[model samples]
Target: MKKQIYIVGLILFGLLSCVQKHTKDKIESNQSRIFHYNNEPYLIKGICYHPVPKGSDQRSFETIDQDLELMVEAGINTIRVYEPIDDIDVLDKINSAGLKVIIGFGYNQNGNYDILSGSFIDYVKKYIDHPSILMWELGNEYNYHPEWFNDDITNWYKALNESAALIQEIDKKHKVTTAHGELPDALALKMTDRIDVWGLNIYRWDNPSELFEQWEKVSEKPMYLSEAGGDSYMTITKQGYEEGFNEKAQADANAKILESIFNNREVCSGVTMFSFTDGWWKAGDTDTQDIGGWAPNSSGVPYDGTPNEEFWGIVDIDRNKKETYVVIKNKYKQTLTEY
Candidate 1:
């Protein structure tokens, strides 16, 4: 009996060692402002995903199997979530499907493991060894909301840098990033020294080409388009495309946007289009699709100047592929071919 117990202990020790090595080997690094995975350049072919079903404001992975299948079909190698995944099984499923995740943490979520609560680090330490993790995203476009940070954006930046520093102290393997709205000013860049990568949620109409040179002048950290895409609904017919649930406008704008992104792979790492599916919960009633939701710097949102938040998904609520989905798949796959 004693011999058997010792053998079991040895087996357990070996399994733990393997987990540690696997986690360490998959570290993400920035070498001279270029993102590298396992020491090789990794251009992210990613999409923002938040599948909150109609009639519910809560995020869920109940349709994960189908979602993963569609994501794999689109040649998507990474997923950007607005919140940290609470389920290990979901992370395992995502890993098995050959996808990595950039997990975002909110500032405050009613004491449910948020930055303000200081419990966000708990989730970080728990998932530190998970192979599917690509980066820990601190916030999404929080710069636009200084009201939450005592009427000053600088305070938020300080907290962001501190959180990032803590994560680096705990997990030296993965990098930390934040989703800033558009290009960061010189001051914002200076304040976020601990950030490994910068994510820009840009919507400068269909042409974001000017941003590449602009970004190169400011910082040397890696950057990716954390959110860049158009919604399906056009409020007014301005650019030859008709208004009202126009998928063509979205597809066309996304095509141009993607072309610009891929064309400037030298400076920009890659893009994770605004979303994977439409959210019925954004504008009005959660049970029905709403037409009016707003986003900053979204005047370039195709024929319509307004962003109908419910229609931004590359896939509809039911998981039907929108025209933009094909546009993304082609561009993403072509990128794979080029590399």
Candidate 2:
């Protein structure tokens, strides 16, 4: 019995050692393409990742690791979250997985915010020196809220400039960015002098080149496809594919936009494909925008377009590949290496 106990102890010790080594091996020192770790162009293949368990809304560390490993395999180097996470170790684990992170210092867990309601500076200070950090994002889509800028545009710029100044003051090493649903006005654009990267979260399926051309006219700064993807193309069946949903359309759209990014490589910094997993929590009870707290719907329903919000993912909740998964993997693998 004593010998058996000794063997079990040894096994536990081995497991612990393996865990430590794995984490260390995964945490790599990679410089950004835009920021230039060593003047190397870092083509950002990122994902807007927020994965909770299928049945529950609570995020599982095990699932996070699993999803991240898959992302790394998919050639995704970065993961952008809307806000700082509650778990510090999870962020560490993300770094250990050889992936970079861009934390958005926004109000609440999601996009909407009142600048005074939260502490943006403290948020920046928390992860300023962390190795995995790539950029500090300010506000998600302030253009959607008229109150954020209104007629004056001062409310928006003041928050961006103030928060950005604080971030740079805390960590001169990292970059600061702001996301707009579309484009900001001239005054707001003029006030964005403090920001390093200009983020555009667009859904227009038109020619991406035209979009980049429009951007170049206003801001010559480095920019990225922070959040750009389409809803599920659910049409029962099309061509040889028969998933009831037209994932091929999604695949085509994602591929085209990425192709456009590559074609406009001189100006485009990188791409963060809208999402990793389809968060059902966004669907709420009916098919509507998620204004409520982040909670999984009581019903475990697969995305079909009733609520388009739940279908903007490369993979489903189970981490199974949607057609866009292969499209993204191929696009990322080719662009970052070949280009």
Candidate 3:
């Protein structure tokens, strides 16, 4: 009996050693590139969302799977989410669904933050082993804060470089990108080696053609519009006003921008619409025109709780496909086939 017990202990020790070695090998191989798909260099076609925020919606595994199925059915291969720490299990589900993830970090209440905090680097070390992650987003549109302009832009670059180096140290296979909130000047910064691509959130009012040209002149790396939209209220007259923009105008702008980007394929990688549904928006949300929040009137009231003009979803909050969905689908199909 004593001999048998000793033998069992020895076997258990060996198994634990193998597990530890496997984990160690993964970390040591960080300098090596392991993230690739389809045997060809692929660009992610994705959507942006805060689907599972802490203390808000705790998305069940089933909910995550269903959402991924919808994205895949929509021909989207990438899903960008903020706060990976909040919903790691959902992230695993996203990976299992064969979707590439652009995970975000460093969100503060003021919206001006940095990866220099090193908290983001620590988080990367934990799950850098996951094969589903295609890239690390230091933060979402953090550069657009006016505070960034106060300091030397080099500071931002240095922060990005350092954070990126740390991530590479843990997993060199993934790329690092910054999500710029419509600040074309941010693209002009000297951080090309630190960043692999430019992620822009372009609103309908911006001059897409001009911005594309400007980015092309500044950076050799590829660019992607992580957020673009025709808010329901986007209109030509509201072009300059904060709240006056109309959806039709936004849609028209989207087509033109997509056409320019697709035609000038050398500079742009791909474009993703801002959202799929009209979600929660607080009163006086000035950061963006809340076009996705309103819907046409079904009752005598001029407006109902139904999605109003500002709601830019390709589908209504109820999941009914909109006219914009057809347009986007047809355009994407044409572009894919042509390319």
Candidate 4:
């Protein structure tokens, strides 16, 4: 009867797995101008994740288990990735750990899988039923690059809107969003009517409160800060914070930034702060940590007022928690209880 026993065991395992499936929460943003998960008002306590190991330029999930443990510890509920994740096992691990993901697609990736090539929809259709998916984000601050779209940014917006509409048509369960630099202009908003939510990659010197007031005057659609936080390395000393890789600069700035975001919850959704771990590949050498890198509209980057791209992570290259990690954990945990 060994054959019979084996078949029974397989059935039992399948049943248990089905019972343990992660929450199949439907996400939407409506007239309320806030995200609702399972019809309950939801806030995205998220982090921008690109865990490229040292000595490499490619994103890797080899340390996903360790990464998830740290993410869970920080009370982060969502991971905002810059590219679609193709591996089913990685998505499974993230789902099993009780987390959600915002999959971002680029306008062009030299033909592989991007919106311009019409291949990004393939990823959407593939992962449409995956429980871990919170939203499908299109483009990351592409408005800053008109040159890429034949010297006309509206061309990019048209493509973005069209692609977003297609994804929504296919996956009615999830919202389609975009990470625009700063705030969208009247033309930008008009062109992107199909975009469900606006993700502003804002940097207003640790004080982004004013943007909410401006947004209220402009449009009522849901919005969130897709990238707002300081890097650890200071280009120059200002305020009372010292220069030279001071973790406190990042910590202090992020603390204030979080405060601004939460205080304006009525007009904005929660933030997916700058990042998870330091990306050594942003500048100079992939094998070493470099201090200098540039970003559009980054004159408001904390005390030093510079992007310092390589040092933006709340955790360092090895996944060691920085002072900012504790700040984020405390804020996110406290906010979770409130909701």
Candidate 5:
């Protein structure tokens, strides 16, 4: 009798979970179908892309075309950028590339609220009508550096909220989101009214389901992994660059993250991997291989700074596809229903 009851309970729980997933899928699918760029739904596959040879505002039509060609091969549909672009032809190039953008307006704008607020509104007035835009990225990893900030954090929130509210008032055509370094930064701040979607640059090594469950408990707004997947290169002393692990490790780690997101599509609106190409210049002119600095916890590990930063790219500096590239390339080809 007890065995029969246990089986029944397990069946009931499975049924309830399926029903819940179906309801969430319905809601997300409906949203994906309308009011988005080109009348499609929220984009599921993307890459945190900056094809520039270096981290500069320098632009060239030839480089843009070459970079986008690789993206085409990878089957990614969207790209997220950090600066405020004023070049019409540059925007046109991105539009012509058959890709959409989530334009970022960073809050680290000299830490001046009045100046930042005014400039934020100005950017909205310029690109709000552009067809290439998908969403307004209001803040970029601003909440992670509290030590750098001497004032109350509420002031930061006030400015960020104002920027989001202004865009909603004037544009109302695009969605708004604030990118944080982690789930805690996103959860610590209050962003109830103005923001539409939540963006997290999450690097959590485990418990993805619990993290999303925690997020759902706190906010019902849609969210995505704005930046993820990095492989650490620990040297003999773990201090300098000597290739700790090969590209296979990065590929596998990212593949696992992609699979997890596919399974928990309810909490995951979309995802953008850390990079498309290796930023050879990230460490400086002299050092090309030591670009992995995004990893913070390095107690038992080798080296310290950012052992995972340089090699985060799916492709190398020259746009050659890595193993991780092949995995995500195949995954990006699938649609929302298929995934």
Candidate 6:
């Protein structure tokens, strides 16, 4: 009888250990380093803004506040701003508005790449404590020219790992991601391990479904669309905006691309459209060969007039929601209900 009791006790202990292990796994899987109001993954949906520097008399805090209020009402929980080197007050305003921020690092002009100077450790220590920060993006589209950094792909990975390590050491709660342009399966293998999540920028010419399928095969991590949409010009020019080939065409393409991603919720985390407004840089301007097809020249230079129809914003420069915005809102509503 004593021997039988000892066997039963061993079985009970084993079961208890299994239960504890399972509980721990569940907790870690659901943990979010960013904003967690009630231990649930905060569903972040929002837009990205071009760098709006503080004390730019043209851009006021009140303007930003109004925009944030609009976004929150539209069901957005976060906003990823361009990497601001020094703008604590603006950061505070963002936090006060109740939106999480994904801070970007690393900037390159032409082929020159530069990490934020100073002790990497000090940089992490300074901002890790900020309540609004959600994640750290090592760079935007840094993989575009790996040869520029170092001909060796391994060197790029090492750099990414180093940056990620610094951020993790200071703030383990926040996640790390890197934005990359879509390429055939052969090219993406280079930077897969360097990032926690994948940031893909898609143009109108590319099929969203096809791109998603190719990336999904090799990557199990969540993905987000860092940039999307094309020039909305009515006229088509080779050097001008090419995504949709025209305004209505661009809008229609945007709707289709977004719909495809939304339907496949299991693999996608979320998407941030290319921009909120027309900016001075004419990269999206169609008239300039240097700037390429992303921008159409409707509003003309310096963005002084009613933004041209080619400007791919849910709202025109006038700040009116377009058909694309309606489609987006409807799709968002459907997703919330279904998910």
In the range 1-339, model 3's lDDT, one tens digit per residue, is 999999999999999999986654222211112123334445456666543222233322334555676676677777676656445787677778877777777644233233645677666776777767777887666664537545565566666667777777767667777777664564445564766666777653423667767765665665777776555443223334234423454455556656765554445566666666544342125334343433222111111212343365565544556665565666665555122
lDDT of 5 by residue, 1-339 (tens): 999999999999999999987665453433431224444446557888765565443433346777788888888877887766667887887788887888887665664322264676787787878878888887677675555456566656777777778778888678887777667445355644587777887765522456677776666667887877755343333323355656655666677777777667756776888787776555655234554444443232223234556666788866777888988887777545332
Candidate 4 lDDT over 1-339, as tens digits, reads 999999999999998877665322222324467866666666888999999999999999999999999999999999999999999999999999999999999988976569999999999888889999998899999999999999999899899989998987787888899999998999999999999888999999988999999998988888888888988988887898887989998999999999888877777789999999999999999999998998998888897988899999999999899999999999898763233
Is candidate 1 or 2 superior in TM-score?
1
lDDT of 6 by residue, 260-324 (tens): 66555555566776555544334443332122333222232111212232355555544566665
Error of 2 at 196 (Å): 0.9
Clashing pairs in 4: none
Give each model a TM-score. Answer: 0.89, 0.76, 0.67, 0.90, 0.78, 0.68
Clashing residue pairs in candidate 6 are: 232-247, 232-310, 233-310, 240-286, 284-294, 284-295, 285-295, 286-295, 299-308
Candidate 2 error regions (>4 Å): 1-39, 55-62, 108-118, 148-153, 235-244, 286-307, 337-339
* Residue 229's lDDT in candidate 2: 68
Residue 199, candidate 1: C-alpha displacement in angstroms: 0.3
TM-score for predicted model 1 compared with the true structure:
0.89
Rank order (by lDDT, best first): 4, 1, 2, 5, 3, 6
RMSD of 5: 7.2
User: How much lDDT does each candidate structure score?
Assistant: 0.88, 0.69, 0.57, 0.89, 0.67, 0.56
Which candidate achieves the best lDDT against the true structure?
4
Displacement of residue 142 (Cα, Å) in model 1 is 0.9
**lDDT of model 5 at position 321:** 79
